[model samples]
Target: MDWLRKLFSSPVPLNDSYHLSPSYKVFTSAFDQEILAKDLERSRKYAGEPTASADRTWRELQQFWATDLALLQAETTRLAGRLQPSLNLPKSSTLTLLIDHSGSMRGDKIQLAAFVAEVTVQLAIKLNLPFEVLGFTTVEWKGAPVRDLWSAQRALSNPGRLCALNHVVYSDFTDGDHPNSLRAMFLADLLKENVDGEAILWAVQRAKAWSAGPHMVLIISDGAPVDDATLFHNDPSYLWSHLHEVIDEFGIDPDVLLAGLGINYDVSSLYDTSDTITVFEDIHAKVLPLLENCLRKM
Candidate 1:
């Protein structure tokens, strides 16, 4: 809860000068370190400079860019004609997007979350995937609230429409005395109050109704949970431990339901050297691949 509180309360300043840091480049995927070690040992005699955009990294980069829904849908449609079920499983029917607005993500984190949310919705529409859009912070709304972007196709047609959606969705955040901690608490409370739980429930309901199909949930965040003294009352792991139970209650195979976790472009330790881009890359290299591993195991 403390983690969530900090996320909500301290929104990052969007207008601040933005730059990509080199730290992101130095880091590698979960398989990167081992693969690099093996390749280095094999080629010790050659001593040639390594290419910047290796094949593996190029594939990941392609996947990242393909996340843009219109392009993805067009490509998928073109390829689906030649592909058999053995090679290409049909796209899932339902998708749930969860963005964590927790702790010090006020500026960059929030912006990215909102951007991804918009893309996820567009993809859902393009593929005719029934989808739910959810934003997680500690805040509560009346009734079982779900924003239906059924018209997401229409909304995404404009060039800068995604940015406008982000502004309105995140504008609800009010500046607080302890903005960082308060934001974290919002996310924490969301977990505690079963907001995410309810979303999971609806997802399972959809999956069961379809009988045999996959469901996806994509989560975007900078992994730090708020570590507030007062809000969490210091019991930090309380919510994370409940995540499995929440899945179990839904009666869905944990591994089959896809979950994509994205790390944002920010590093707390970047102050030492003004290389913000490097910091973001460093954190992404360390964290994203780790997260991918965990998701695969699930």
Candidate 2:
């Protein structure tokens, strides 16, 4: 774990291009498969069986044209006595994960954060729900502002894409050319800078524009908001005020749930100090229940 701190102590230049370095290959190969498998299994259980019901609309009747007329007519006549219309619940919630990769998250903290992210992503995929993963930290390195680590639009194209990097390691070394490689690097770099909670505002904007369904933002962090004065110099209450403004402007309420997963620290002070926050001294034991509880809330 101390090596992790030493590895990131010296800031490495950000690699904008998507490439998979040898270190990334080694890192992903070690952890991705097992994580993916476990997540997929859990997701399937949560997804349950797909249910089917009779379609009673003219739009559905169009399928009859594609069938053999004789067989279709016979089936239709046989089933004419028991035709009914039904609808299944649509997967309408979009899960947005906001992971804090600040300097404080080095070692086991970052690993657990990544693990939580993997599980959530797999569940979203199994439920056929759209999801986005984002990482936030300091605005700069080497005296210059850094760029966004990963965005929902850039890294995640679909649920299947999760399987593509299932064997890739999460690292910051720049050598290979792949989208997931960049993501791995981004997660690795979470340990490089201080926390900037204002980054959550950017995530909120993206969630508003990208998702049509109810949005759920789950933030995983180890500490309270920091770097506020650095990002917003005008108002001391900028973070809290801005959050309320966004909630009002977007009309996000019961439909939009904001939850936090605090590791080794209580982040409820950063939030409303309500049931919305869940603190864990360690994530290994309670991760599953934690995920399930959040899913239930949504």
Candidate 3:
């Protein structure tokens, strides 16, 4: 009963004096250090040199031996097709991470989302890829609209700093150290409110302006888009239609890749055209594989 009451309650006003720091913290004791370390190691293993384009030359033929044996005899040798690399990712592209810091993503869900974001930043830096990390909740939050954890410009200039996880788990409201932490704090404060998934479109628009090359947006969330502030009507399909309109406005649907990591609910609808929306079960066993596969595609 209390939980339901709190869910419908209005959010408190933001503090004007509170400011998010420019420098971010690389480590935090809020989460299990061992798990974080293992995830980081896994990201490193997956961050091998970006695969080159397919090589169709005879020297690089995949079935050279078989072809030679057939050529020696009177039998005609079948030409071996080009060997495509295991992971042919884009060399010059922008990687945008959109984390859902809504009330539903509290407890273990939020922690896992942060871990995924952390590992992604590390992997992007390791591969020398330009990237941006953004966290979004309600539009009424302090950094409302969207909070930038690491901007594309900052990432390109100080790639070395991004090699480590620069985020903290905010289980409390007053725990604001960096911009990312501040966003987490705001999310914690309003931990029972509905989320606005359309915030992702805002982040995507910002990322497009940041880079002209190909862009990949990965959204980590637990629930569907349900913002009473914007969608006053009781239609459930409004979120879906709104998202499609936003994507159409950009006109970069093909160039932009959308991937979703749904925590509990089936968020596949949120990414209707995406082939990479995976329902979350276990982070290490389920989510990691999906994330790696998406990265390979990028």
TM-score of each: 0.38, 0.48, 0.50
How do the residues 1-298 of candidate 2 rate in per-residue lDDT, one tens digit apiece? 4433433333233232222121111111111121222233234322322111111221232344334333433433333222212212235556677777566776556655654565555455445456766666542342121111112123222111111112112221121111132123123322444333334544555555765556677777776544432223223343344444443433445656667677777656544321222322233345444555555555
284: Cα error in model 1, Å: 16
Residue-by-residue lDDT tens digits, candidate 1, 103-148: 4554444444443444444334444455554444322221111111
Which numbered prediction scores highest in lDDT against the true structure? Answer: 3
lDDT (CA) per prediction: 0.33, 0.41, 0.43
Residue-pair clashes per candidate: 46, 11, 0
Report how far off residue 264 is in candidate 1 (Å).
3.1
Looking at model 3, residue 175 earns an lDDT score of 18
Error of 1 at 120 (Å): 2.2
Q: Report how far residue 276 has shifted in candidate 3, in Å.
A: 10
Model 2 C-alpha lDDT versus the unseen true structure: 0.41
